[model samples]
Target: MVETSKVVVFQVGNEEYAIPIRFVISIEKVEGITPIPHLPDYMNGIFKVRGELIPVIDFERVLYQRPSNINELTKIIVIHTNELSLGVIVKDAKEIIDIPPEKIKQLGLIAYGKTSYFTGVANLDSRIITLIDPLKMVQSLDGIKQIQDFMAAEVNT
Candidate 1:
């Protein structure tokens, strides 16, 4: 028996990226975010959702090394992995898709360094979506442990 992976697809720049639906908590509009200092530039800041503060990271900054082109269509994709809940800002939240195992291919070695989080690429006809492991993505970042610790303390308080 084979199982298909359900993913939430979202736009970042001209490319499309997907994260498994299991990690997604919610998709929210960009209402407001309070900027925090001394964090990485990609770390946008913290935002409130349901009385809980979630650290926001710009997907564009993480991918393209620039600020996200925030607009009315921009959204924050809340994802929880390894006990940490983070909000990633994206150009837009597209839709959920299911990719069969046969359609997924492992990325080449050239994409292994900075993009180690990319588990595979799914080709659904003409659409090519990069699949990312949210856990690995978060773990690959430097100083994310500090943010995780901060979040833990916030939760305890």
Candidate 2:
């Protein structure tokens, strides 16, 4: 018996990215995101989910340092982790795919500098999808402390 990890494949511009399906809450249409003062451009802002407000982030901006194009194909993936819960805008929300341990490659030391957001790379058929750790991505930002403070101080008030 082999253990398999379920993952969701999504697009940021032309690049395909993946996250463990267990971290995903839902796939939703891009909604109105309320902008916050002093927030990073990649932070996008916050949106209401049920009664809770989740900060949204631009996947393209965070990973590629470019703004994500919001069009008909774009969607927001609501992801939750122990440290952060937020929506990530992706160009297209592709289907969920299973990644077996054998197909996933661990990142080497050379891949460490700028690829901190990605935990590993998944080879899914003909294409390779970089697996992003959304929580880590948020945690690594320069304004993360402020975002955390905002989330704690204002978001609930």
Candidate 3:
């Protein structure tokens, strides 16, 4: 039997990106993000979902070094890993697509310098989507340790 990864595709700027569906909690409408102080520019703030506080980050800023322009189509892709839970702001949540292992190409060494989180690219003939490992992306962020500790404490209290 062959294994195909199901991923959630989302828009950031003009490109489409994908994350493994297993990590996604939900697709939320952009709302009620309470800005906090002293966070990295990429860290938008924190928000509550079912009483759980999850730190939010801007996908565009993390990728392009510019904040995302929020509009009606904007959304938050809530995902969680063993380390922490987060809400990533995206221009739009596109669709879920299945990517076969054969269709995914690993990133080259040169591309790894900055986008270490980019696991591969899915070639679908007409278009390609960059595949991201959410855990790696979140871990690579500056000040993530403090954010993880804060989230852990929030969960405990």
Show how many residue pairs clash in every candidate, following the order shown: 0, 0, 0
Candidate 1 lDDT over 1-157, as tens digits, reads: 6899999999999999999999999999987798888888899889998989999999999999989978999999999998588999999999998889999999894266778999998898889999999998898877898888877787899
Off by over 4 Å in 1: none
Q: Which one wins by lDDT: 1 or 2?
A: 1
Residue 76 of candidate 2: its Cα lDDT? 91
Model 3: per-residue lDDT, tens digit, 1-157?
8899999999999999999999999999989999988878898889998888999999999889999999999999999987788999999999998899999998784266567889999999898999999888888898899888777877898
Given candidate 1, what's the lDDT at residue 63?
Answer: 90
lDDT value, residue 56 of candidate 1? 95
How big is the positional error of residue 67 in model 3, measured in Å on the Cα after superposition?
0.7
Q: Return the TM-score for each candidate structure.
A: 0.94, 0.92, 0.94
After TM-score superposition, the amount by which residue 128's alpha carbon in candidate 2 deviates from its true location, in angstroms, is: 0.7
